[model samples]
Target: MLQLKVIQEVITLILFVVFSLVFFKNETLKWNPIIGMCFLVLAAYFIFKK
Candidate 1:
């Protein structure tokens, strides 16, 4: 379970970075809210994780 938590954190972080890059690279991509949401969900998930 602890391993799962760590993995989730890592994955979420990766996703955040990827999304930010994509948003930056593409003007058509509106990633503000999506990035915000990903971070928020990751934070909540980790905070509540055992």
Candidate 2:
């Protein structure tokens, strides 16, 4: 249950950023957000690692 929650949160955040970039033209992708997304991806990787 905990693992699922963590995975979902990470995926949701990543998807949110992606969708925002795709759907919102005024929203620009910055370095900070990109770095943050990299961290989120790392977190997701660790969560799924056995």
Candidate 3:
């Protein structure tokens, strides 16, 4: 189902972000990637908007 996929993707993204932040302290978070993630979640929202 669309809803299930969205939830899984969001959870995966959060886990990946947390893992990256905790393991890769040398690299600072950037706005572009953050915005890109936001767009991904937003796209999922639109898909479920119907």
Candidate 4:
């Protein structure tokens, strides 16, 4: 149950950023956010890396 919740949160975070980048023309992808997203993805990877 806990693992599922963590996965969902990570996916949600990624999707939110992706959707924002796709739908919001005014919003540009900056370096800081990109780095943050990379870290988030890494966290997700570690979580599932059994």
Candidate 5:
């Protein structure tokens, strides 16, 4: 279930960001975290690719 874990991680990251943004107005989103999420998405892509 490595694939499952990777997908879960990607979804978790997305939800975490959304939750933080919705619940914490004072906190600002930064480029670094976005970049990290992008990389995680890329990793998920490669793992699922055949």
Candidate 6:
């Protein structure tokens, strides 16, 4: 179960990056997506740190 959670988190992070990159390419306001993802990654890392 723990391993699955870790995998899900990693996949979520990757999707966030890909989504942000694709969004930014076509829209200017997509910066929020990238910033949001960065914060999410930071929070997730700290929260899950062992």
For model 2, the stretches where C-alpha displacement exceeds 4 angstroms are: none
lDDT of each: 0.69, 0.84, 0.88, 0.84, 0.95, 0.71
Sort by lDDT, best first: what order?
A: 5, 3, 2, 4, 6, 1
TM-score of each: 0.47, 0.71, 0.72, 0.70, 0.93, 0.48
Give the Å shift of residue 33 in candidate 6. 12
User: Could you tell me how far off, in angstroms, the CA of residue 13 lies in candidate 2 after the best superposition?
Assistant: 1.2
Ranking by TM-score: 5, 3, 2, 4, 6, 1
Model 5: lDDT equals 0.95
> For residues 1-50, what per-residue lDDT tens digits would candidate 3 score against the true structure?
97888888888988988999999999888998799799888978898897
Overall local distance difference test of candidate 6: 0.71
Which 10 consecutive positions of candidate 1 have the poorest summed lDDT? 25-34
RMSD list, candidates in order? 5.0, 1.5, 1.8, 1.6, 0.7, 3.5
Please give, for residues 1-50, the per-residue lDDT of candidate 5 as tens digits. 99999989999989999999999989999999999999998999899899
Instruction: Name the runs in model 6 displaced over 4 angstroms.
Output: 26-50
Please estimate how well model 2 matches the true structure, expressed as its whole-model Cα lDDT: 0.84
lDDT of 6 at 22: 91
lDDT digits (tens) for residues 1-50 of candidate 4:
76788788878888988899889979888899889878877877888799
- Candidate number that wins on lDDT, 3 or 6: 3
Best-fitting candidate, scored by TM-score: 5
lDDT of 1 by residue, 1-50 (tens): 76667667667766876887787776454688568667767766776678
- Highest-scoring model, lDDT: 5
